[model samples]
Target chain A: MKNAVAAPLTGVPTPDLASIFGGFFWVGISGFGSALPFAQRMVVERKRWLSDAEFVDAMALSQFLPGPNVVNLAVTLGGRFQGPLGSLAGVVGLVAAPLVIVLVAAGIVARFADSPHVIGALRGMAAVAGGLLLSASVRIARPLWRKREPWPIAIAIAAFGAAAVFRFSLLECLLVLGPLGLLIARIRRHPTSS
Target chain B: MNSPLIELAVVFSQLGLVAIGGVMSALPDIQRQVVEVHSWMTASEFAGAFALTQAAPGPNVMVVALVGWHVAGLAGALVALTSLIAPPAVLAYIVASLWRRFSGTDWVKDIQSSLNAVSVGLIAAGAALITLSAAQSPALDVVIIATTAAFLGSRIQPLWLLGAGALLGAAGLI
Candidate 1:
């Protein structure tokens, strides 16, 4: 039942606090658009700390738990190495830049809230954001497409309609759609494949 | 009466606990609290904040900071940021340790696969919302499709795509 692709190829190599914090600090700073892939590159590619499979597994575990995906990855991966302190380092390193930048942006943008150019650029940025999100969706759903299953695909469409068109909040869609999808998967005995 | 700082922390920490399937999924609920429940900002303010944050660098969760700053300046910002991650970080730590230890176990495998499917649906839903919100003009539609195609077809870094998008926006194409 091994996933040949995206499988763990390495074991944990002890990384000290400086490396962990410094690595994640850069991840935060360079973490434009989405942070997950940056974190992935930092951990799995450059750091050689976690293999691809471990990163994916850690992501799935945290994705459903709470908070942001990359932040959860930071905390969880840091915990894997140095327990609570590691998690703390991960959070601080990943957040510090964004916190400061967002604060400054909030302050500055408020003063310029009525500028036509500013509004125009933000509108364009929003459109770009849409592209990023759409790319993320396709990447995540890529595996399900290969499996040739209609049910998970249906679930994806339903979930989309609920959130985007029907205007249901995400949790509302998940609460209603999650359990039913899980049940169907359990019945099929191969949940992810479908 | 409560200090808005305390209220910010309380509300965010509480939401952080229940904000499943990633924080993006929790954005609407957070908006509901800040705009409608807390009366800290108007609806348009909330939407603008969210839109700008999506286009910002770093983690997507920084929107919490923007909302807090809008509501009560720097203290509100700090409190909102802290509370948003504290509870979830603790839970994530425990779950990560458990998963690292028992991931290969049959029951663990089952749980992972089940949740993985749910994640797929949830992310797709989030994408849909982003698309609908971002799309306003035909030019923007072209930008969205081009960005998606470039991402799906090439190995170009997303930062480049975002930069290109920003440049296009600055030029008034989108």
Candidate 2:
């Protein structure tokens, strides 16, 4: 009965700014195309700072907000753990290494942009990267599996169609679908007493 | 050739403002602004930078930095990247603070769920867009499908897949 109203989770010790930087800095260097898996493993399994469900909640929150999802997650998670400085630390940790590495690679690659093998490899890499991204989408939307409702699926399809098929401007599409989605979610907001 | 550091910053900042679901959602627009609008780089070069991001560690948005370097050296790279990341990171910080304070509420959860639903669709669209642009041959198409299926079905690491791609391409198989 004490737990019936879903009291906010408490007592997870917040990591200091240094650990925050190190954890996400590791995420920066370790990830390939998408950092969500690595970030999830770091915070959820290794750091034990946030539980699995909390990790998912953070993912959902960051995915919709502006900026890179990884950066947003880092900022949000870092802020939750410490404060604004932690937020800055998280983002700097996630971005600093890749920024240097990518710039250097860009420098070297510019000299070789014309080689056919390099070009072909680049093209092939794009296909696989696309695959990685689509696969990630399949993975990120896992919670819908529990809902067992068709409306969420339908909304997803409509969004995919509008963006991928119709090629409407992204802002235009979001504005149109945003309210409908809220209405659907509102209808299903019955509170469950745990 | 005239695309400069300030231009990179201004364009990326504008992109940052309207990039509702992150930079992948803004890919085509980035292509538009970077390739056609500003003439910063060729379309093929832009595509190549994107591929570089896939191989390099971290988020795919690193392609912007690559594009910046390609055009105007280190300063351009710094400008493009900071403009794209800084604004949104601040916004994320502000929103995250508020969200943490109000997170236990039911309405907040409901709104989050709604946004989540929409994100599912956006992710699908983003994957489709990248796939369409990259997979132009039957062999590449097979690579795309196989990699995607494997990723969805198994826990195979993405680095392994990218390595396979590089090997296939180096051997001229794709």
Candidate 3:
């Protein structure tokens, strides 16, 4: 998947490490609720290091593996462009900004956990977080729903039903779905060829 | 104290490596480990801490720091946060390098596309679980469902909805 184009000459102007780090830092810091969509917009659309196809690929891979999707995406995309060092840079940029903000907020919450006002504020924030998460689900689902694949859609429904209704452990649910997905893919690949 | 702190760091570091579909998907495992196995906190306490983390403005993984802080102290919080982020960051670096080399293959593309749909399902399931846990009262349940509907409707920006929820809470309606 290495792009055929040569790396930009060292002396030529390019997006500096500082600028790239800053961009990811802001994106990470501002990610209060809907960080994934915001990060996608910044990296894929605004920065243009990756095309739509590549962005989708990176996102897909990240989601399938462990860790936060945004962090994984950063590493994947960064490595694609600038090797292991770039991946390190991207991860630092992506996480440090958000981690700092969260630490400060946690301290504030600990200080005021007993206060009525803080309690009320937290309640409200919780509701809003629910909204944010719901919105993200819809945003992610919209594209997938458009694909018109019955099996994937069926698997999605079954997975959701199992988790939401049966309260299956996340690992158990994935264990059931992961192999099923792989089997389906294999079948599709070698259907008549097999 | 040192043992718990180290344990907290190690467990959450392992969690960071396996937290697919964000922190929420890992919630079940976190609850199982911390509340059930380690006896660090009660299930209710973990739920409460999760509420706080959701309210806070950052990734859900930040909840690890809050839980660690509660379990030990500032030092615990630092350990938990580092463990939660650092291991996964390193893992992502290794995986990214390999991905870049092999991503051009047809099978890779096909598998990636199929997994996208599955990811959406996992995320939705996680949200549904959170909604159930957060809605304690019938009125609050209605509000939660309404907010979810509003989110799905695409009627307003999520931040505005947050502002409204906060205002309602301030007014004692929520």
Candidate achieving the largest lDDT: 2
| Clash pairs for candidate 3 | none
Off by over 4 Å in 1: A1-13, A51-56, A190-194, B1-7, B28-51, B137-142, B160-174
Question: Which one is best on DockQ?
Answer: 2
- lDDT tens digits, residue span A1-194, model 2: 11111212456566878999999999999998778789989988888888788888778678757778898888887777677777888988998999988877776766777877877777777778878877888886777877898877888778778867876655666677777877777776643531
Give me the displacement of residue B101 in model 1, in angstroms. Answer: 4.8
Tens digits of per-residue lDDT, candidate 2, B124-169, equal: 7767766777778999989989998999999887778887887788
Candidate 2: clashing residue pairs, number? 0
Model 2 Cα shift for residue A187 (angstroms):
4.3
Kindly report the docking quality category of candidate 2: medium
TM-score of chain B of each: 0.74, 0.81, 0.77
Give the winner by DockQ: 1 or 2: 2
| Lowest lDDT 10-residue stretch of candidate 2 chain A | A1-10
Candidate 1 docking: what grade?
medium
Which residue pairs collide in model 2, if any? none
If ranked by DockQ, best first, what sequence of candidates would result?
Answer: 2, 1, 3
User: Which whole-number lDDT from 0 to 100 does residue B1 have in model 2?
Assistant: 29
What interface RMSD does candidate 2 have?
Answer: 3.2
What DockQ, between 0 and 1, does each candidate earn?
0.50, 0.55, 0.50
Q: C-alpha displacement of A49 in model 3, angstroms?
A: 3.7
C-alpha-based local distance difference test score of model 1? 0.73
